[model samples]
Target: MKKISIKIVYKTLLVSTLLTTFSCKKVFDVKPQDQVDITNNYRNVYDANAAVIGIYGQFQTLADRYIILNELRADLMSPTANADQYLRQLNEHAETTDNPWADPRPFYKIILNCNDAMANFDKMVADGRMTSSDYQQRYSDVGAIRSWLYLQLGIQFGSVPYVTDPLTSIDDLKDASKFPKISFDQLLTNLIAFMGDGKRYLDVYSTSVSTTGATNTSLNTTVDGYATNLFFINKRCLLGDLYLWHGDYKLASAQYHYVCELGSLSTNGSWLYDQYLVQNGDGNNHVDIYYGNSTDERTLVDNNNGGWRAIFGGGVGTLTGQEWIWSIPFDKNFLPQDPFVNLFSNTGGSYLLTTSQLALDNWNSQTQQNGLPYDARKLISVRTINGQPVIMKQLYYNVDATSFLPTSVLQKQGRWLLYRGATNMLHFAEAACNDATLGTSGVKLAYALTNVGVTRVYDNTWPAASSLPTDRTNIEQTFLDAPYNLDGRNGETPYYRGLWYRQVGSRTRAYLQPLPAALASDKLGMETAIIDEDGLELAFEGQRWGDLMRVALRRKDPAFLADKVYNKLLRDGNGNAAAVRTKLMNTANWYMPFKL
Candidate 1:
């Protein structure tokens, strides 16, 4: 049977049994059924590995879903067509009344499963069935995943429960009324300590940490393939993330840099530094692994109306570039489609391109750096259908024959994007090219904090040129300086949280949207946590929303950018995507409903 069906059945069983909450008391009290017997399952490494892998798979889905709350909590997007209204209440920017699940029910399920697995795993070690080395790794893997999830929860909910012991009954698990809560800082501090312990174990286990980074396809494909670890990427990702939450930027940077170095390491001990690659084969280009070969890989369409082909408001997306330090590789298992066609997509209404102030500013600023052509690395190209050439963006060939644009190409509606075909967006956005005349028209913001809320306008006039620094760190910092919402530095003060919303594509800040009496103070009155949260939460996700309260606690009020982005493109599903559509229509979107 298809894993899809199995997944469906799993969810059905779980949801039915867990309407309000999974009652651990109920699980222990119920009659046992045909569950996989763990004793025999532990004899060999194969099944044991699979078990660990299973933990990883469950972790991936929920973990992926869990992060969305942070995005919502930080005002990255408002609840629209898809998320439960309860979730929308937590957007933090909004004057929310309440919801219960936000208390941490579902995510805990994932945590419990991991812990349960760890328990069984530790038993295997105690019996001498497994080596101490294996045992240590298992501990680290659990710590990594659990730490990650808990940290996210802490950030999303100021105080959340810190559950280490798996429940005696699976039934007692779901009763939200019975769950405990902890302060965000406390939970974070505790997890940090746990990770520190796990790190000591990890150090003694491996001869030396094998730091090779992973591409998206690999991690997504083997969603639960880690027994000792969920592959190096997650491990690397965890370590890097851990250091950041601990307020150890230098260590955090080192952790990420360590992975980057491992990725570049050669057998001879030399390093293969970044190779500057641009989309050159077609007018529209991207840096992506465009296909996957796994029988269970994520394909373009789930149904006739499903698939990447159906999601395009413009063209579907493609991956191609230096933007990704390390991504899933393009192999038989991934990179299934022709990346070029998807490049021309318009990503639903996001392609309207009227008020994306931040992108415009970043592009112009980056381009002007080092006296390079005023055009930033993100180029615009337009070509003829018959392999002919012309001034790109000329109205004649503009629509379908273009290249990279901006973040406004997608908007949230249940899922931020809803694209399907790679070609649907081909002919859109042709109207604006070097649109020196582009103004803040159709910039219909539903609400703003004061005036425009947070926003930034780009004049399109190339910035004053400066010399390019050869140092990679310097280059990264330069990109960091762009006045756009990013995820690495401080950003959470009310002022910072409201920055992007305030800059609604006008040089003049936005007008005020009435504040609720409940709101503590004016946005500007806030500290810089807004900037810090933005830097951390939206670091690579193509976003800038920061869970400001976390910032209020972390830095204690005032915050500023020191740094985030979201899904700009994808080559496959779960690190393994279907073939790239060479002849499909397109519409583009940023997110999809639950992978199922």
Candidate 2:
């Protein structure tokens, strides 16, 4: 009943590195016949325990890739700095797509994993290494995992080869020659049905496990085998996330909401972590997902690749956030955050990344007050420099994309409240209040207001003040000049010329940074075109070029600034109508093609 964050037992999935691995050992290696040496060896419960533990091991690998690629997919357009960038590309655009190179991987890679688990585990469930036993009964239970994996791929790609013929699709017949995904929605429908069948089959089998005399007495054995079921059960939650991607918010909301009900909220930190054999792998070293570091340890799970010191300079800060809900915990024995990881995670564009610099003129100045009160968040929430409440000065106030940053700007020491897994108790005190002024849709907002002694029916809609909230026209407005000089204690004044970023008056002028395409090459391992403009959201906004695409709101050009500034059609003196028409006609060539 104790809440435990899933991070302790989670892992990302991966296909075998060489064309032969399917997360764990090669499927062929685990084929019933190949296991000829091991099956006869499970004479005790310990061996059986390994079988289940292996399943969790594989889940960790699968989970890793699953979680990271998603970091790419977070909804950016929405308030969350999140975006389905890749998925959006896949969905909105077609054949002349930016990333067709990935066209079939998501589907097959998963199928390969599911199939591998099934084939290997099938032999054991049969109860006999050879002679026919209850294999059919257990196969369905195992199949649930496979079915759900297929569902994830199907929902995203539309058409996927069904699991009914997984063996033939992957083996007897060359999968290389077959299309891994078919674009019709029906594949999604069928795959979902398969998942249901697998789940039902599993439920019945679970009941059987509970009653049968064949069961072993060791509790850990049961817990370990739980991995197989974990793989399938987690899929149910995935189905919810997938539905949200497809715009079925109603269904998606219900799915997530339901999972919250069934799967008790995860505890902040968990201790049931697995330490795989991958050296330099950040996956382990963190025992649980509880908020705040119980002890600091560096992990393969680290964002910076062991170079935080040289990169971000020195002890910057640890990565902590309310959004993590779950995270790889670090204890010294487990992978802990190193000073290096701390340093790298701290560097940002300017005042945002650096620690307090009293050398600057106003470093010791009294805290600055919020210039605008129309928006209650800025007025009542954040604090001033010396010691008073004021609007938050950081860009993307509620969000921190960069992990490395000074504790001052990073808001590390405090804000730890967000990481608390406790329920009923408020995590964000601000959201609990109903600031008659803060645009909120319900009383939840008012709860926080009472702490301020204000009371009223919580208004759920955005208050008029928020509709057109006022912010510094540019970063410079706060300083003596414009964007370049630093008025805040957090950083040194920055300056650069023609580089598209530099100190100007008091603000950092906003312009599209040059994307030197030449820097890209197979040898360099850098992007051919810095799709991430590296301008507006430099410090932590993951990629920039994608943002320009979203901001311009042009479905046609994934290329930056050009769409917003270049009005090709009106170019006669005004603009060239013919040129504009020509570009529009050539839709396929517009977006900068990423070298996959």
Candidate 3:
């Protein structure tokens, strides 16, 4: 199947922007009913296609804010000279209502677009202009996208007003009390419901127009052109993520396992990819995940060439990696341009920067000092320039290895890969570990070793599969004694009989990063191990803060939340460690308060 390129057009008509930052002065210029040409605009399949593309366009605009707020607020990133006041404030955990990135407007705007597209297409179907299957496909696509946006909102802000219908009038905002604030748990429930409907309407296997019996014969003929596009959001992937967040471990595992199962199939359809996305030196590492081993116009890198950097911005021109299940598309010459490439790349105008010791020390400890071989992630994720650590995760433009590129070139190539294969695999591991009823120490350890120990460990010197102990006490003790084992990148010697990530680093430095509060005192070593692995595997991907929040909230450990940030402050000493620790220790500080 051929991949579709997302070309953004900025001729969208805003339905209602009253009392919001994105609201235009012309909000009243267009009539409530005639806000957009819904009746006339969606008359043809081409027009309907334009509307769907516009929905993805909204995601492009959201790329910068999504990354900035999620990452800058975490311990992994701190502000540099390029940072503005708003950026600095966010790093300091002092968010204001006026902070543009913190505002929920972008999320709501995308939801409104989804609502508009779905409603107009429904009318078209009712009028016999569109087919029933076509309507189902479009409805499914829009619902899943909306649910994805809602999940982000719920994660950032605890209780937000759940708006299902489009707001057509200023009166809708007049009565704030009418809008009910949905809790994070309740929001996940609603999102699950949305995923259910989306899955029912979407096809597991892509079909041609003749096979689908669709009225839009021109576009729906191939799996690539179908309205229920596999590239936008995979229903099972979305469902699995939702299940994981909802604490339904068995259900989450089932969904992720299904994805993994499909990857192993020889004749799998468009819904699942067949190869691993990123790999280490040896092909044995991170095996059996989804990816594209071949190269075409859609993707620039092939099996022999690409790894993490290639999958992201290994100087590849296209965002067509098979591992990318869902992503916000970018056009270098469009209204909503990409920002990450420049933000991380531009040494001339750097906005976000790497913390001095957190990443560098981590790289040294694991790659050089540790008995295991060097991890490839360190080379791809961070590099030291003029004795300062800088992030190199998503630099799209070309640059010399030691120096930062100019921002102008960086902005021209900003692209964001939202979801990938490794993300799904790790989620599966986490779900298994956290599963209350179905989880056991052996099961969790097995899942962890499969994803991290065997697949991601660089030296491939992880303990033999037969050596891992089945008992929980033995596993805990094995980790506590990991630092003493000195087998370096060689499987010849019998070593620690437990998970590969048993001893991440010395106790003093590693504790600066948060430990999962849910872990027992005996299993606390695993907390630092998980945090280290997550940092290395998913670094510069906008997940650090949320990961900390999840563990902190679940364990209710103030020290866990305070330690990482406080340690950073003590190193820099710009802010008072006691004040910052006090603020973060408070559970409320974990999330940005709802500010519409």
Candidate 4:
């Protein structure tokens, strides 16, 4: 592979600079300006603000390729006929040097921007141009973003040239002597250290000031008169992910727990649990199903669109929902137009990709809590377009009632969901389930998170617990004790019911049945269930491959990932399924070739 120069990599940066006057209303609306030397640009707060937005502008360019690499390479998505060889090669696991998505330059460009910003921020703080408080918030934000980008690079490319210093030329990267390539494990270690224990970094930014009148401004603040935390990365969430990939389950659980607790506090307790599925007066025993006036279970009625669908399509409210912790928004009016419209939409897009049969079959194979066939999230997540299954999560806010298609493509504005509530809860459960100290109790909590709420898991009368030993009552009470307990029933506080009292299991929220009690003590079984639940709940959102890779690596079982991708290919009728599986079994074939 030929080495590319930094000049060629960030040519766009040289042609136009993000020098627009800072406006809280137009947070991401960067305008083109004649090239100015960025070396002397970091002098004040507004400059820091512009620098942060500029970094995000570069980061926005990554949305399309990020989703393509993460999803298409996994089992949930496949290239469509319209897709070019570049995309098809990804699904086939045969990507060559020339594939556009295979290039690491785009990721490095954002890292470069982050590096430059952080270096300058440090200088500003030392020279007294930026206050320590201001530096702490902005510097940490840029650092977390950099960590996230590198993690993505590691996930896709196995070993990456981990460069920290802002490079004067891309040629420096070509010289392995200067920037030695680091393996994914090494990268995780470096990032974990960089992110620290999450104490020095500022938590969620607030709109309010301290009693001393010290401003608490951060990238999480409202933009365009609307509250938005989507533009910035969540520090704890990123740190937790780093720890998770590094095999530090206890630390990972703690970080994830912090995010969950913070979410509850920030949302006034309504954010931790999944939204309730109200059971209308129907003869059905399920909370999610509606049978109209008929008693027959087969009778069809209107499907409730607001339950899980609202998380994506609930408009501005979606931004504030507890589910979304970190996301990146794209506006058509902006430099990086909404990428998914072209990638996922058939009407207004080229439709380069579609939901794979494997994903569809996986959803269909599940039984809902109502004993109904298929999960309801499938309806909101995927839909038929021109007789092909299109991924609807990114394109539409809601499905059309009559056509069952997207009401319209979100052409003007769309979001790249990076982290959310399910991510926090499930990751915590995974860490707990794997931790040696937590044992079967940990497995029980993990099942509760995936199936039903904690209340039902601890219920002695619940059928699933009837087989347990009589001596287990005391152990179960410890789980229901203060601090660790999460009850789903109304309590003494007025807001208690509104908060956690309405809690349901993550899978339960999707109308899926809980895992049988037989697997509660089975660590591998619970881990597998958690990973599968990840797919059912968060599929097609750019996390499939990472989840598979992390688990496969932890267990030292290459077949874990190979089998899934292989089965997906077989389901898609791809002739390469056997070949791909054979190659993937070696683990070395899991990553793309590291070419410039």
Output the number of the lDDT-best candidate. 4
User: Residue 119 of candidate 4: its Cα lDDT?
Assistant: 85
* Tens-digit lDDT string for candidate 2 (533-556): 122112122222233333222223
Predicted model with the maximum TM-score: 4
Q: Name the lDDT value of residue 389 in candidate 4.
A: 82
Off by over 4 Å in 3: 1-35, 169-174, 197-199, 202-207, 210-231, 265-304, 314-322, 347-352, 367-374, 385-388, 397-411, 441-528
lDDT of each: 0.31, 0.27, 0.53, 0.70
Alpha-carbon TM-score of each model against the true structure: 0.46, 0.37, 0.73, 0.86
For residues 122-193, could you state the per-residue lDDT of candidate 1 as single tens digits? 778888766665566656666676776676665555555567876654346445577556665577678767
Query: For candidate 3, lDDT tens digit of each residue in 96-177?
Result: 8898878887687777677767777778888976777667766777787888788888878878777777665323543668
**Residue runs of model 1 more than 4 Å from their true location after superposition:** 1-39, 75-103, 169-180, 198-233, 264-271, 275-554, 558-596
Could you give candidate 4's per-residue lDDT for residues 344-455 as a string of tens digits?
A: 8887678899988988888899986667778767776887778878887786533454564545555346667777777778887788788777778778767766666664
- What ranges in model 2 sit over 4 Å off? 1-52, 55-110, 119-180, 201-233, 242-254, 262-596
Global CA lDDT computed for model 3: 0.53
Q: For candidate 1, give the lDDT.
A: 0.31
